[model samples]
Target: MSQPELSEDELLQRAGRGDARAFDQLYDRLAPRLFGLLRQMLYDEKEAEEVLQEGFVQLWERAPSFDPERSKAFTWAVMLFRHKAIDRMRMLGRRNRLVDGAVLEQTTLGGSSQAADEALQDAERGEAVRQALNELPKEQRQLIECAFLKGLTHHVIAESFGMPLGTVKTNIRRGLLRLRDLLKGGA
Candidate 1:
């Protein structure tokens, strides 16, 4: 019989242990979805492509620290890429002010108006995610808030909050699973 397909969580765990094949598999599964998200967030194809590349490099560097017990591989990756894309947006915003008038004119002339439609959809989805997060039990919601909203890692959260590492990881895992379910049902 053929080997069973490994879950993304399992693959990520293996990748953390230096399994190149597992890393490749994880990349194949996640890149398209992540790229699409970057496109929506950035609304610039070249910037999205650059952020995607940079995000993957960061992922590989950070893989060894990943704990499947805390969060699913895809969600962890999405957070990483989202942060990268946000940083790119901030940098672009700063640079746009320094550009010549010709550059501004060129961008407005070439830019897609579809970004407005995507922004509306993104806002709706963000509201749904916020509602779902609010529905979580207090402990889970707080832990998730620390992790995602504050951008703290499990270790840092544990240290900062005086909780055991395992407790922090468990709460995050449960909260993320619940949040995923809530988003899917509401979406």
Candidate 2:
């Protein structure tokens, strides 16, 4: 007679007790499906693979804490992979934004200026906006730069700068209002 296959819960229970073989079996059964899910979320093959490895490592460490009352073992594992993939995506997005911002800043700095009257008018408006931005407090200016110029969300900016989300939002709002007032006065 053929040996019966162990169910996921059985495998998880065994693995939780520090059975390496059971854990290996669990990894073999779930890795492909979890990796596929991660790949779909991340949209990059290499990154998906890396996140898969990371997820499994985390699972190995956390297997002892699995609770059947809260979620199935499979669901818990999938959540780990999903969270890892989302974090990777956010990190990549932040990096891309920074690189794009740098490139744009370089392009603007090196741009050739036309001698036309319209070009002069546009330059003057740009200068006014820069002057207004410079007039704001340093903290407000930094928040505005991260939220507006770099296209970061308030939550992301808060995490990056280690500030509270409410504080970041407040600073951005105040900075924009101050900038608007300065522009109106200058005009």
Reference-based TM-score of each model? 0.53, 0.58
| CA deviation > 4 Å runs, candidate 2 | 1-3, 112-187
Off by over 4 Å in 1: 100-187
lDDT at 138 for candidate 1? 64
lDDT of 2 by residue, 1-187 (tens): 9989998877887888899999999999999999899889987777788789888888888888888888888998988889999998996666455545554455557565634564556556666666676677768977887887678999999999999999999999989999999999942
lDDT of 1 at 93: 58
RMSD of each: 19.1, 13.5
**Candidate 2 displacement at residue 36 in angstroms:** 0.9
TM-score (C-alpha) between model 1 and the true structure: 0.53
Return the TM-score for candidate 2, rounded to 2 decimals: 0.58
Candidate 1 — worst ten consecutive residues by lDDT sum?
95-104
